[model samples]
Target: MDLEFMEAHLPLYIEAAVLTLRIAAAGILLAFLTGLITSIIKYLKIPVLMQIVNAYIELSRNTPLLIQLFFLYFGLPKLGVVLSSESCAIIGLAFLGGSYMSEAFRSGLDNVAEIQTQSGLSLGFTRSQIFRHITLPQAVSTSVPLFCANIIFLIKETSVFSAVALADLMFVAKDLIGIYYKTDEALFMLVSAYLVILLPISVIASFVERKVRYAGFGDTSTVSG
Candidate 1:
């Protein structure tokens, strides 16, 4: 490994990593909101909207992020909707991540017992009130592991932002490799950059997951007590 070359190129990688993180954070936030709303719609089984959400989930999950980015950055301009590359990247990541997040949230929501909901209903709690006060908290707690996994997955998916001309870490690495032929140095920096970003998140997520599990946050039986 060329330590000198790695040190020289570190700033480029850092800039790219920052861009990547910003894009990932925006995408992840949008995805979480989208997932939460869609999951709630599914849970409530709203007639027309439920079918639409189901189709969106299926389409988003079934397609590759690359294809989605291409459609956003390239195809949309043909239809008179011009989007910047960064916009395309964020939208595509959200489009892809939202489906996965929806599934995670839906799984959590499903684990809440029907009896608990019924008990709330009998106590004169509105449906929205029950969800806000009881269901949402338990479901979110139960789904922490899944949420962490999805966030990591979405961050990694930002690698494809290069396809939309975003100067993400993957783009910088590939550019350096193509221009300077320093494949080893470029790849080493890329890996290290990702490790810096993801390692702490992975460790923290594991710690939080263990804490939630130990606290019995998702145990359906505890609902009665």
Candidate 2:
């Protein structure tokens, strides 16, 4: 019930909030690109490369992200790779988020017209151009909703950093609770912290989804069939 102590620690909460945002933003960016590339690889079936990437996605998806974070933070340094907690969290989130994001993109890529590939080939587009012009755009458009959801999931997942000793929002909130013994206030703040981080993404995602659907991912205007 030390409200004063908890109130005084507000600045610490704000700082941790910034760290959480940084981790989520940078991690999502990396995940999106990694997922996109993996999606394309699976879509095109590029032999050994596809197999390797698919195995990675499956492995990461099947395991706990907490373990992944620990490995990056604790174990990787034994191999001469050192990283700060924030860096480790970001890297772990990227891989963890990338695995699910890749699957979302895989399903989206599947939904893209098979004939679009033939159409692009008929138009004399190279493999790269077909992917660039025909496949990626539609696949991404279709994947946006799932991608947005995954981004939110990843944002929430940032709290797992506490296990790795990263002073992210959850970490800071835990400390505030311990110091002030105000469980209600600390819990409310933790909930508010995640709401602040995720609500804007939800809003923006709704807007993008509106536009994408209006443009008609299923309209069948672009494909050659």
**Of the candidates shown, which would achieve the greatest lDDT relative to the real structure?**
1
Q: How close is candidate 1 to the true structure, as a TM-score?
A: 0.92
Candidate 2: segments with Cα more than 4 A from true spot? 1-6, 119-129, 214-225
Identify the leading candidate in terms of TM-score. Answer: 1
What lDDT does candidate 1 reach at residue 209? Answer: 86
Candidate 1: which stretches are off by over 4 Å? 122-124, 214-225
Candidate 1: Cα lDDT at 127: 89
Consecutive 10-residue window with the lowest summed lDDT within model 1: 212-221
- Local accuracy by lDDT, each model: 0.90, 0.83
Tell me the tens digit of each residue's lDDT in model 2 across 56-95.
9988899989999889999999999999988898889889
Question: lDDT of candidate 1?
Answer: 0.90
Question: TM-score for all predictions?
Answer: 0.92, 0.87
